[model samples]
Target chain A: MTSGLDVRGITHRYGKKTALNDIGFSLDKGLFCALLGPNGAGKSTLFSILTRLFVPDAGEVMVDGHSLAREPGKALARIGVVFQQPTLDLDLTVRRNLKYFAALHGLAGKDADRRIETSLEQVNMAERAAEKVRALNGGHRRRMEIARALLHGPAVLLLDEPTVGLDAETRSSITGHVHNLASEQGLTVLWATHLVDEVRGSDHLVVLHRGKIHANGNAAEIAGDVSLQTRFLEMTGGGK
Target chain B: MKAALICLVAIVHREALRFVSQRGRFLAAIVRPLVWLIVFAAGFRAALGLSIQPPYQTYITYEIYIVPGLCGMIQLFSGMQSSLSLVYDREMGSMRLLLTSPIPRWWLLFCKLFASTAISIFQVYTFLAIAALTGIGFSPAGYLAILPALIVNGLMLGALGLLLSSTIRQLENFAGVMNFVIFPMFFLSTALYPLWKMAEASTILRDICAFNPFSHGVELIRFALYGQVDWMALLWVLLAFAIFLSGSLWGYDPSRSMVRRKA
Candidate 1:
């Protein structure tokens, strides 16, 4: 199947220290894929390169058949990013943050308004749209970010360590909501995290460690017999 | 096109509200120069003599001499302040949102420049109004003439700040800006003292002062205060604006990958 996000022999470094080494993976369009890695496995680095915040040292990134190098704007337009931190301007209300993002995507006017409303509704953030970001809890902020990311109707949604500080309930609900979006709306997702349970058996999973891909396949297939925790521990060489 | 403008307005409006919200910044913008104009200049006026220049039809008080310099100071600080905000915005991820937009990088940077210039102009006028209140007033026609100079000056200073923001990489770098950039530029120029006085002190310092972009910037404002033109000053200020703006754009290009590793 054609992939939504493709990486071929991607390598990145920070000075003498290597971060990602010949990493190769592809996520099919409309797939709920998990980029699972240990701490310092270069997940965030990968995310930065993907978001065009940092250019990769070596690699090719294609989003929906568009080459990132050749047409960065188009590639950027095709993907939505939800960074690990709560990036909303605390002084701005949820609606204002959403509106700012809409403008980024060249979306405005009545169409932007409709899309903003629709995206907020999807994350159930419409009711709190007028509330300043500082007033919202962690889960609510993440929801707001999700709503903002969706405003542009991107084909690929990239979440970097998205559920870092939320309760298990909220985490699962957010994961489930993202999963549903992938299936129902054909939104390809590259959900990067260290959290084991966030990935389901059906979801595509890539295990990264020491700046290398350890394995790539269905989560259940790799985690078979042993728990995901055990497999992940063995891969990172950090488990006692 | 319309959307960008709306975003620009919202951003600029937010900055204005932020200025209103933080009363200290306003106080600082006006008070520093006000102190210089009234107390310091009154003391200096008797000692140092200034001949009539192009803008000044006759000899004026030292209070009036540095009005444009103070205006330049306002532009300089507002520009640096905008850079500080850019760093904060990067940390907060708002810059990411703007950069990731489908718009060209230059347009986004220009939008930021426009927003900052607008804020700087507001600060300039506020400073002028305060100056007028202290009997350091300009003619109403002069005030009208100054608007364009304020914009050009604000833009050049803002561009310098943008260039610094792109190059500095972190908030700690601001200390370096103050010591290495702001202080040197302010002190080295004919802001507090006349260039002829610097010539009296030392020709090398005086020659350097004569060539300072800030010297040109101040001249641009000084002439505007008298409702006249300084084409040389205008050319130098515009040249500095072009250079700094180009440097900022070069530093911020995504392909450079500074944001990736730095952040």
Candidate 2:
């Protein structure tokens, strides 16, 4: 069976400055992968490439076995993305936003409505679907965005810093919801973050620093006796 | 084909909702031109008496003369407003959502242009309706005829806006650039006066106005409002649309985007 995501030789540069260098990784179906990195560790750049917002200088991104370079539409259809920055139209209702996204993926009529309800239910935001995005607090807005991203039933879900700026309680809830999505819905997940606490011992982790992966394994196995936070700091050379 | 249609309708519906939600924008789109019509045009009525132009078979009032220009103004502003929203969308990250859709980028951008143009048409008719109620009336058939003309002109200006929005680096720079564009395009064209009147001022200015693609858009609407067809004007507008569309498509090319360069 084809891997959920197969990235190979992903290298990108901004003029003379290299942002990502020959980075490669693969995530299997239903596995949750944490792309752990610091603020300037090229996490966002990699997410941009994965989302096809920016084409990497050299790389191959395959979503469900469809090559992004050759079949961008097909590849994109297989992967749902939530950007680090909020993407909801603030003036639109939560349901309106989801419906619009569903239509973009060619879902409509009762099918779109059904998926909208299901995804919102998954995020536990079904009751707030009629509220305008601006009326919702930041946490609810983030939940609505996540719900919108899942309406198409993508094989892979890519989120770039989805928990930024949220309160601790909200952040943990969103993280828990996504983790449950991977296990319960059998969805592939690649979540990029600078927050180490968000990673679980059982989850696969790829530590990235200065455009290169420093470690890749089960979080618990790699960290061993130390906490994942301390291990991440040590791997990135920021340890005390 | 079905997917394309669904995408178009969804985008158009979103644009419509945005337009309605922003009542201030609707008010401004109308008031800017109405001020020119009721105040500026009223003041200039005696100063600039229009003679028998091709589009105007007899001596016409200045209000009548500037109606097409006002329609063009509505579309032009609406187009630029659409451009402003796009820049905002890019900053706020909603543009990424739109860009990541499985539908092709070119088609999506075209849908955006279509949606804005569709909204501009509604605003133009609303202005015309107000004018009609305020003792400035035209042929009802002429009103129907101007629909296609307004669309062609709308597409031209909206395409120009798309090109500018894609190329512009920041939202702060957009307002000044819009002023530079809107005032020049409005003043230097045959929008307020006939080209012959421009020729009366200076040969150089006349030539400049003659070369302005916006002049052709105004003239196309002017002729259409009179139930006449100006093939030259129509051709010029279409050509401008083609050039601007191509330029915008290139400007929005992912490889050429500012984010890629800044990264």
Candidate 3:
């Protein structure tokens, strides 16, 4: 069976500097994979490749059985993305933002409305749908973004450093919410972040550092006798 | 095909919605042209005596002569404004939402061009209406004929904006666009003065204005406003549109360094 997300021999470079070096990984369905890496660890580059925003110099990405390079439209249709930066229009209402995204994916009219309602309900932002994004707090705006990403009902979700800049409590809540999405909805998720605390012992773990994958396995197994935090630090050389 | 059409409508609707919310943009678009038609034209009327031009069968006042040019100016600025917004979207990350869509990238870009062109057309009509009320009017049929010309010219200018946005990485650098692009394009074109008038000044300057695609665009609008077709101008504007659009697509290609360099 095809995996939810599969990358092989993926490589990218910026001038003479290598950003991602022969990175390869795979995740099964209903799994919350934490792509733990420090700043400039190539997590964002990898995410960009997966999202088809930047084509790799040499690599292949398979999203739900479709090859991204050869069949980008079909592969892209199967995935949703939440970028490291906020992407919503602050002047538009939450519902309007979601609706605009829905239309980009070819969903419209009543179908778009239903999906918008369902996604908002999932994120618990249904009550704030009428409020402009500028009126919402940082956490709520992030939730609205997640709702916006989920509007098209993709099989795989990719979030790049999504919890950055939020308070600890809000970060934990968002993390917990995303974990529930994977476990409850059979959605495969790749959550890229530098925070070691966000990775659960049972979760899939992939450590990226300086353009390479240093570790890829269950979080507990990768940590072995030590804590995941120590293991992450050791692997990334304190993420310097 | 159906999905593509739906995407097109959504993009256009969103642009229109944004246009409505930004009331200042609409006001500025209308006011800028009026300032020229009412104030600048009044000052230049006596200085620049007008002979019957192709589009003008009889002697006309300076205000009437520059009306088509003012229409072109509206689209030119509207196109650049749209470009500024695109740059803002890129820096602000909203463009990621657009580029990641399942729809073809070319189609998405085209939808944006179409939407901006639509807005430009709307602004042009608003200006023309106010001008008509002020006693500077064209053939009733000429008003209708100008629609197609406006679309072509708007697309050409909007495509130029798209090309610029794809290459410009930061919002701060966008100020240079107004200086290098907007001012030169507006002033060098036949928008403010006819090419013959420029010829009277200097052959080289007239030649430069003649070669400027924006000049052809103004000529197209001018002829169409009088129920005439300038075949050469139409072809020149279309050629410029195609070149600019293709360049933008190349610039936006995922394999290229434009998007990657920004990231």
Candidate 4:
């Protein structure tokens, strides 16, 4: 069986400085994987490579059995991404934003409307669908972005620092929502962040430090006797 | 194929909606041309003399002579405005969303060019209508004939804008583009003065104006507005469009340093 996402021997560099060094990982369907890394750990560069914004120097990415290099369109069709920065048009309403995204993915008319509605409901933003994005709070805007990402019903969702700048309560709520998406809806998720508390004990955790993976396994097992925070600090050189 | 069409429509529709929401932009697009037609043309009518050009069968007023040039000006500014927005979008991260779509990257960039061209064409027609209301009118058939010319010219200028946007790394640097590119291209072209007038002053300046692609765009519009065709101008504009579009495509390729540096 094909993994939901497979990164094999991926390497990337900017000039003489390597950004990602032989990084490799995989996730099965319906799994929530946390890619925990501190600042300058090359998380953004890896996301850029995965999203095809930058081509890797070596290796390949497989998304739901589709090779990113050989069949980019098919691979892209299966992957939805929410970048660390907000991508919504602040002047446009919530529904209009989702409709625009849906149309980009070839959804139109009744089908587009249905998906927009469903996605908004998933994020509990259906009631505010008519509101302009500029009128929403930071947490709500993040929710709207998540809704837009899911409008095309992508098989794998990749979020880079999704909960950054949100309140602790909002962050936990958003994280809980995404975990529910993986568990109940059978969606695959790779959530990248520096927050250790966001990783559940049972979740798959991949610790990336200085462009290399230091640990990848069940979160509890990786933590072992120590707390996840202490283990993460040790793996990443005591937070440098 | 259907998906591509849908994506194209969506992009164009979004551009139109954004254009409508920014009333200041629409007003600026119209007022700039109108100012040239009403004020500068009036001031220069006595100083400059226009002979019987191919597009002009007889002596014409300065306003009538400069109308096509002003149309080109509208498109030129509109194209640059579109480029400025592209730079802003890139900085704001919306461009990443567009580039990561399932559709081909070239197709996405083309869609953006098409949307910019469509918006410019609409602005040109609106400017033309305002000029007609001011008693500077073209042949009835010329109005209909100018549509195709406007589209081609708009696309050529829009492609140039796309090329510039792909190379421009930040929004703050766009002012440099205006001073270095927009002013020189507009002033050095056949927009305000005829090539013959430039020749009387200096042969070198005249040759430079004649060689400018924007001059060909204006001449193409001028002839098309009089129910005629300038085949040379048409060919030159098309060639420039091809070159600019190709450069923009290369600039936007993922492997290229232009985009990689940004990443």
lDDT of 3 by residue, B1-263 (tens): 88898889989999999999999999999999999999999999989998887978898899988998899999999999999999998888888889999899999999999999999999999999999999898888999999999999999999999999998888898889999998998899898888899999999989999999999999999999888999999999999999999999998898884888735
Please report the TM-score between candidate 2 and the true structure. Answer: 0.97
State candidate 3's DockQ. 0.79
CAPRI-style class, candidate 4: medium
Q: Model 1 lDDT vs. the true structure?
A: 0.85
TM-scores for candidates 1 onward, in order: 0.96, 0.97, 0.98, 0.98
Name the lDDT value of residue A18 in candidate 4. 90
lDDT by residue (tens digit), candidate 2, B26-62: 9999988899999999999989877886977788899
Q: How far is candidate 4 from the true structure (C-alpha RMSD, Å)?
A: 1.0
Stretches of candidate 3 above 4 Å error?
A: none
Q: Could you tell me the C-alpha RMSD of candidate 3 in Å?
A: 1.0
Write the number of the candidate with greater DockQ, choosing between 1 and 3. Answer: 3
Looking at model 3, the pairs that clash are none
Candidate 4, position B17, lDDT: 96
Tell me how candidate 2 scores on lDDT: 0.90
Q: Write the per-residue lDDT of candidate 2 for residues A23-87, one digit (tens) a residue.
A: 99999999999999988899988988898887889989999999998899999998889888998
* lDDT of residue B20 for candidate 3: 99
